[model samples]
Target: MSVSPTSQGQAAIFIPTPNYLFSASVNLGTPLAPIPLLEGGQRIVEPITGGTIGGPGFQATIEGGLAAPIVLNSGDGTKTQLAFIYAYGHAQDGSPFYLEESGIGGGPAQTTRIIMNVGGKFQALQKMYILAQPKVNEAKTLASVECYSVPTPV
Candidate 1:
């Protein structure tokens, strides 16, 4: 997707700020993409042919654990503060993973949220997908964090 045009007198290409940022590999456990949710917070696995309802959501991770503070910036020196909600765990793929919690934790804000500590390596390698909902804009995007870790012998 195209990022918001940079201020005049600036470069022509405005690098879209990544709404979702991650520190490490945390499997999403499943190929759960385009997770469908209808009005009134009802989950739907089937596709909705047509309907104007809520927007999309995302998944992300902070290296080690999010038990600490997360910094958000506008990519450039611009300090348009942003907020985020994150979770950690493994996907249903039988590997370790993490994800953002539902509700307010993932809501918008001007400051950063103190995430909970998520530690542990999955028994097997897994791929991760991070979905982000930009607060300032309507368009949303998905990012994947792939992990290829080999166990170290004791």
Candidate 2:
């Protein structure tokens, strides 16, 4: 017996493949303390030659292998300017893991937040990437990540 051309089993079947999805949602609000302005350290919305604010910097990490344009959401406080630096390291596969530098050969996209003040709930986005660094002879991975922004003049 032959299946009919118009039958559900033989209607010139066309199975479409699933498309690739790239993107992630990261929660950055984890009660972060003010990053102290240190000597010789670059900060957001502040000149590199200015004195340190003498506070603690915002620190957090994200899951590696996230597609470009990672969304960083933090419900804490507000300020001006933000920076996300991707630390280079090795992956579990022993392959070098690195996030392309901003503006480097079509590097990963980035988005900055314009916080108004500090001491309250706030949210922001960080599109940059933080390379994955798997521990030697270990399965866990780590990446040193930090966020910075300046408060509006009172």
Cα deviation of 108 in candidate 2 (Å)? 19
Provide the overall lDDT of each model, using Cα atoms, as 2-decimal numbers: 0.29, 0.25
Please provide, for model 1 over 19-114, each residue's C-alpha lDDT reduced to its tens digit, 9 standing for 90 to 100: 333323222222223323342232212111111111122232233222111222344634332233354443223333443422222234222222
Segments in model 1 whose C-alpha atoms lie over 4 Å from true places: 3-11, 15-87, 98-154
Residue 120 of model 2, lDDT score: 16
Worst 10 residues of 1 by lDDT: 46-55
The lDDT, on a scale of 0 to 1, for candidate 2 is: 0.25
- For model 2, the stretches where C-alpha displacement exceeds 4 angstroms are 1-21, 38-79, 85-154
Please give the range of 10 consecutive residues that has the lowest summed lDDT in model 2.
46-55
- After the best TM-score superposition of candidate 1, give how far the Cα of residue 29 lies from its true spot, in angstroms: 24
lDDT of 2 by residue, 25-136 (tens): 2322222233445432223221111111111322222233221222222355323222433333332233333333221111122243212122211112132122221111
TM-score per candidate, chains pooled? 0.21, 0.21
